[model samples]
Every structure is written in C-alpha cells, then in structure tokens.
Target: MAARVWRDPVLWLAFGFGSGLAPVAPGTFGTLPGVVLAALLGLLAPAIGVPLWAVVLLALIVLTPIGIGLCGAASRRLGVHDHGGIVFDEIVGVLIPFLLVPVTPWTLLLAFLWFRLFDVVKPWPIRWLDRHVSGGWGIMVDDLLAGVFALAAVGLSVHFWPG
Candidate 1:
C-alpha cells in the first residue's frame, strides 16, 4: 500500500517529501530535505535580511514541535511506534548541526555524515532518551542529540580547518 503522504499534502511535508518512503535508508533520505532547506536559507540569508544562523535557529525552534506532532500522529495512524517512514524527526535533527554554522557543501556534507553516525549509534544519554522517551518525543529526542553531537563535531572541524 502507498503511504498516506501520497494522498495528503500535510503528510508529504511531515514525511520529508516522501524521502522517508524509501524502502532502504529512509532516515538518510528523510534528512535530505532539511539539508536542502538549510542550504537554501544559507544561500538566501544575504538577500533575505536575516542571517543564515538565525534562519537555522528559528527553523529548529519552530518546526521541531510541529515535526513531533506530525510524526506522532502518523505513528498513531499507522499503529506503529517510530516507524522508519515517519522521519520528520530526522529532518528536524539535521537542522541542529547547521545552526550558526556555514552551510557550504563541505560543511553540510560533514554535518550530514556526523548526524547519521550519531543518529545510528545513539551514544550515552542519547541512547537513554531513546529508551525512556515515548511517542513523538521518543522519535525526536535521540535524533536531536545526534544533531548536537554533529554540531560539536562540525564546530571542531570549522575551527581546525585551515585556509
């Protein structure tokens, strides 16, 4: 059966433009929309008045909850918990590493790699949250931590990378 997102526009956004519908590696694909969004915001920041960092920060703050709600609702409708195809959480998580960071291809690629690593590994408190938290929060929290981990890694890279 096709995903509800195919029939519903709202679900389409929540599911990260059907990236989450991929049979393999949905999480990775799902994160792509956030990457594109960050890149566009960064590219447009100069023309748009707001700084790239501000745009990234605002997006994470505003959209995180909405992603949570959407993921939770989708999970409920599907009768499953944290389904792979419900990856709005991945999109939200990917945004964190780019907050206040340059959105160049190099930086974005590094951040994406780190986000995926931390997301898949689920280290320490991230793993704890994954185990204890439930519902949409459950789906979102670990990825949020992964983004933070990636943020730190990306920060270090930015600092150390020489001209």
Candidate 2:
C-alpha cells in the first residue's frame, strides 16, 4: 500500500511529496514545501522584477485549483475523506499569508505558527465549512480560511510591531 502510494503520481502530489506521510504532524511537515515555494517566489522579485505579493497571488490562483483536483481525486482513491495523508491543502494554505506580507524569516515563522493555530482550532466559519463541505473544495477551503486568519493576524502584527 505504501509503495503503491509512493508510485502513484496523483497521490505523490496530494500527499505533499511524502511530507504528508509523516507519522505525526503530517500537516506541519507538508507545509514545509509551501515555505520553500514561497521563498522561491520571493526570489522572483529580484530575478524577474515582479513584486513578491503579485507573484504570491498568481501562485495561489494557479495552485488552488490544482490542489482541489488532486485532493479530491486522492480522497476517492483512498476511500477516505480528507485523510491525514492528504496535505496538499496545507501546502497551499500556508502560502496565503505571503500574499500581501513581506517574506522575511520572521514573517514566515509567524505565518507558520498562525496558520497552524487557525487550522487546528478551526474557529467559527472555518469549523463550519470543514464540517459542511465535502470533497476537494471542502478539504481546501477550511485551510484557506485558516490562511486568511493567519494572514490577518500576521499582517496586523507586522504593521504594529514592524520588526
């Protein structure tokens, strides 16, 4: 079973390139890829002269749909809904805060912490959506909302603290 999961391309991606396969805290491990992706996108600002926020926006636009498809398909294949092994949503979720904030180490750390908090807590609408929605969109939307919560929290923190 594990070998088949590793060999399948869709599962490979939906599982966050094996990060989601971790014995514990798979979401946290899976989010590492998003951090790497966000950092690379940050670099595009100097390389192509594009703004970091714009690049992040474009990345979110592109990745969200792809994540949805991959997540939903993986769920069907596994005969499970939003399995622990499916962390593509987490990978995409962690990218949201970077949309408007500077991609500094401090910001990354804050984003990770805040995103994880919101994801784990699932306050109000996030929890509601997580329970009500189903399939790929269901799995992805809750985390996306958590990302928004993290984004707002991080944005405010950066604004007031300005470190």
Candidate 3:
C-alpha cells in the first residue's frame, strides 16, 4: 500500500513516522531513525559539520514546538496525541554525542552505548525536565540530556585514555 504524506514525511525518517502510529514502544522505534541519521552525519567534516551539527540541535530545540504543533494538528486531523510518527527528538538527541567526537568505529560504539544509557537512565535534571515539561519539548528534552551525558563520557574517555 502507498503511504500518505498526511501521515509522514519520508521513510528515511525511519519507521519513526509509522512507529508513531504503533500502539506500543513508539519512542523506541522513533529513536532508531535518529541512530541511522547520526551515522550518516558522522561522515561529514568536523570543522563545518560540528557547528552544523550543533545548529541542527539548536534547530531541533527551536523547531520542536513547531513539530509538536504539526503533530498536534495532524493528530487532530487524524485524532490522536503524541503520535509515534514524530521522531525529530531522536535525531537531535543522537546528534549530541556526534557533535565533536571523532567518527571512529570504537568511538562510535562507545558513544552509542553511553547515549543509550543516559537516555534510558534519565538522571538528575534530565529526569526533572522530562517529568515537568509538557508537550513535544518534554518528549525531546530527556533524550538531549542523555546525549549530554554520553558526550561527557566520550570526551573524558578521549582525554584520559592511555596510549
């Protein structure tokens, strides 16, 4: 069956667009689209790419409400809330670890592990923000915090690891 644009943008967003429609684990599927996106973006140059990556995060933070609004409107049009199809949060969250880290296999592996840990754990202010914030921003903030934790660990590992 053909997909309706009214439901999603493109499949590259991953099943996140469709996953949003899923009855369960929409967040998990929504996050996968982001993982792939990070790997692809990691291929870019650190000079331009790092800043660009940060900009993407800024844009995501800035644009989240817009996205949520769109989602909300879509939900109203379709009748739902917190649709699984929206995965921009994952994209932004995943980008945090990759922003400055070297895109090596080992580094990528470590970053991936760390990011997932923080995301799932949701420590400190991340947990607070996740609980207090409402709407799309709330959905996205926790992951961004997770990325921060991952980035810190990756940075420290790079700084402290012995040759």
Candidate 4:
C-alpha cells in the first residue's frame, strides 16, 4: 500500500492543524504559517501583492465556515475545545497585514511581526470578542480582530514612518 499522506500529527501541527489547541497561545503559533505563506505570496506578486492579499482574504472568507466546521468536529473527536492545531484563524489573521501594504521584504517582515504581536496580545476588542464569543466563529474572530488591529498599526506606522 502507498504511504498515507497527512497521517502524522507533527505534519498536521506544522500545518497549523493543532495550533488552535495550543494551550497558552494558540493564535500565536497558528498564525505563523500564514505569515510565512503571505511572505511567499508577496514575493510572487510584489506589484499587486495587496490585491493578491485580497484574494487570500476572499478565499479565507469562503473557507471560514468549512474550516470552522471541520475544526469544531475535529475538536469534538479529539475531546478538546478549539484545538490549537486548528489554525485557520492564523491563516486569516496574517492576510490582514498585506491588505494595502507594499510587498517588500521589509514590509512583509513587519506585517508578520505586527500580526503576531497583535494576535498574542489580543488588545481591546480582540480580547473582548475572544472572551464573549464561542464556537467556530469565536475561534477565528479574535484572530481576525487582532489582524485588524495589526493592520491599523502597520498602516499608522507606514504613514508616519514611511521608510
């Protein structure tokens, strides 16, 4: 028989399958892969990177329900609540940083760091939303809010620091 693909938990974890279940910081690790993916995506389309990011956002929106459902079901199977491995939240979170930003290496790095920081810190409404919310939407909402905050930070920093 052919070797099965995606059979390893490490493989799944590396792909953010368990990022959602991360005990202390699910979103933090969960979003890292997205940052890496966005950086790669940025490199492929530096000129229209922001538009490409929009495409990613659209794709994420379409996939959210499916992702949430899968993650929720998986959580039930695993006997866990929001398993850290379910990292669609991270994928969604990282896309925000590239929405309007130029796709230079520096910008990509900045976006990654900004998104990670915001995701981990979970300030203001992100924290509020995270606490109040539940279920699959809840799993992704906090990271989405964190992404918004990160995008704002990057925007302001770009506006003022323009270097």
Tens-digit lDDT track of model 4 for 38-129: 77666666465446666666656776676566555655555556655667777767777677776666666677788888877778888888
Q: lDDT of candidate 1?
A: 0.82
Q: lDDT: which is higher, 2 or 3? A: 2
Question: Rank order by lDDT, top first?
Answer: 2, 1, 4, 3
Which has the greatest lDDT?
2
| 10 residues in a row with least lDDT, candidate 3 | 6-15
- In model 1, the clashing pairs are none
Q: Residue 105 deviation, candidate 4, in Å?
A: 1.6
CA lDDT, candidate 3, residue 3: 57
What is candidate 4's CA lDDT for residue 31? 74
Question: Per-residue lDDT tens digits of candidate 3, residues 63-125?
Answer: 556555554455444343334555556556666776667556666666666776776678998
Off by over 4 Å in 2: none
Alpha-carbon local distance difference test for all models: 0.82, 0.91, 0.60, 0.67
Which portions of model 3 show Cα errors greater than 4 Å? 1-29, 46-86, 160-163
In terms of lDDT, model 3 sits at: 0.60
Ranking by TM-score: 2, 1, 4, 3
- Evaluated with TM-score, which candidate comes out highest? 2
Instruction: Name the runs in model 4 displaced over 4 angstroms.
Output: 1-27, 43-50
